[model samples]
Structure formats: C-alpha cells, structure tokens
Target: MAEVTAEARIEAPTGKVWERLTDFGSYGEWNATHTNFPDGGPETLAAGSTFTENMKLMGFPAEVLWTIEELEDGRVLAIRGKGPMGVIVGTRYSLAEDGGATKVRIDGEFTGAAVSLMAGKLKDSATAALTESLRKLSGLVA
Candidate 1:
C-alpha cells in the first residue's frame, strides 16, 4: 500500500470549512479535482452513506464509489472506495482549530499494481494536488 498525506492551514473557521467540506453535492462547481458528481438529494453522510463521483486523475477518466466509513463532527471524515484497474483507495479528512485558522489534513491510501509502480511520483503529485485543492476550497469559502 502506498499513502500520501497533505496538510494546510486555512484562514477560515471550522464551521465554515465544514460546511464547504460536507457540501459534496456541489463539488463539481468549485472543485477542480472532480468533474462529474452524482445528482442526488442532500446526503446526511453518516456511516454507510454512499456516493458516486466521476472525476479525472492525470487527465484520465476515473470513477469513484465512496462509502462513508466514519465521521466525527469537526474532527474527522473517512471514506473508502475501489475502482477498476485494481484500485483500492481510501481517503481521510481531518480538521482542527489553530488560533484563528482551521488546520485541515487530507490523507490518502492507494494499493494497486499501477499505483505501487509509481508510488514516489504519485506521492509528490498527491501532495501538490491536495495542497492546491485545499487552497482553492479556502478561497471559495473565504
């Protein structure tokens, strides 16, 4: 298994950030990473809530089927999914207050033949992409 983690401090309150984070329904609007998010009613996102999103990784079409594994208000969110191409992936998002800012961390685990072969480069790309995505999220909510 290969993992990559990225953290960013945003100039926003935890409440504001949480709202944006949980607004999965509108991810495609401002989220640069996801291109096509499923059209569904609002999701409560408790354990077992499932979502489907079509996105791109390195400009290649990727479909993700995410199921909420855990949730802790203002603290943690974890989701797991698997896709074609032998992909097994998990994502975790955590948030904490730091003075006047919110510290957000995104950690990802990917295990697959294709991922293991380029683990090093994937780590670097994940770091960069997550950082930029967080920055964008902060800006959108700021």
Candidate 2:
C-alpha cells in the first residue's frame, strides 16, 4: 500500500478541532481546496455509515466514497474510500490533546495502479496540501 501521513498542531482545543474535522458537510467553506457538497456529511459515527464527496488531488477530480469503519468519539475516526481506476484509500484521523492545543494526525493508505505509479511525488504534495488545509481550518475556527 502506498501511504501518506501528515500532522499539524493547531492552537485550538481538541474538542473544538474534533468538531470541525467531523463537520464534513461544511469542510469546503473553510478549506477551499476541497469540492463542496450540499448533503455530503457524515450521518453518524457508527460503522457502516457512508458519505459521498467530490474531491481533487493534484488537479485531478475524484469522486470519493467514504465508509465509516471505526470510531472512538473525540479521539479517532477511520474511513475507507473507493474510487475509479483501481483506487482504494483508507484514512484515519486522530486527535491528541496538548497544552491548550490539539495535535491532529491524518494518515492515508492508497492502493491502486494509478496511485502506485506516482506515489513518491504524490505523497509529498498531498502532505503539504493537508498541512495547509488544517492550518486554514484552524484559523477559521480560532
């Protein structure tokens, strides 16, 4: 599996950051890098819940279908995404409490011919994008 993991330290409290991250419906409002969806939010934190969204990666449009596979309230969220071109992506969002801040970690695994072909370059770019996205999000909620 090809993987990319990125982390960011946000000056927001863990609870606040968790709420913003899980508020997938409004992600595009603050994170301009993501495609907007009217009803593209998580229905529930339970496993088996699914969410559909349109996303872009390195200027390529992608339809992301996420299935909630695991959850630990306020701490961890696990999702699996499927897309065209042999794409299978698993992502985990973890939140850790720090002094007056939140340490957020995002880890994703990509399995597909398209992803493997450009893993190294894609990983670096994706990581940077994630960092910036989180930073923007933090600023919005701060």
lDDT of 1 by residue, 75-124 (tens): 89898887668887788999999887899999988889988787887677
For candidate 2, write residues 72-124 as lDDT tens digits: 99999998989779799788889999998999888878888888788987787
Tell me the lDDT of model 2 at 82.
94
Give Cα distance to truth, residue 66, candidate 1, Å: 0.7
| Model 2 steric clash pairs | none
Q: Going through the candidates in order, what is the number of backbone clashes in each?
A: 0, 0
Q: Return the top candidate by TM-score.
A: 2
- Give the lowest summed-lDDT range of ten residues in model 1: 33-42
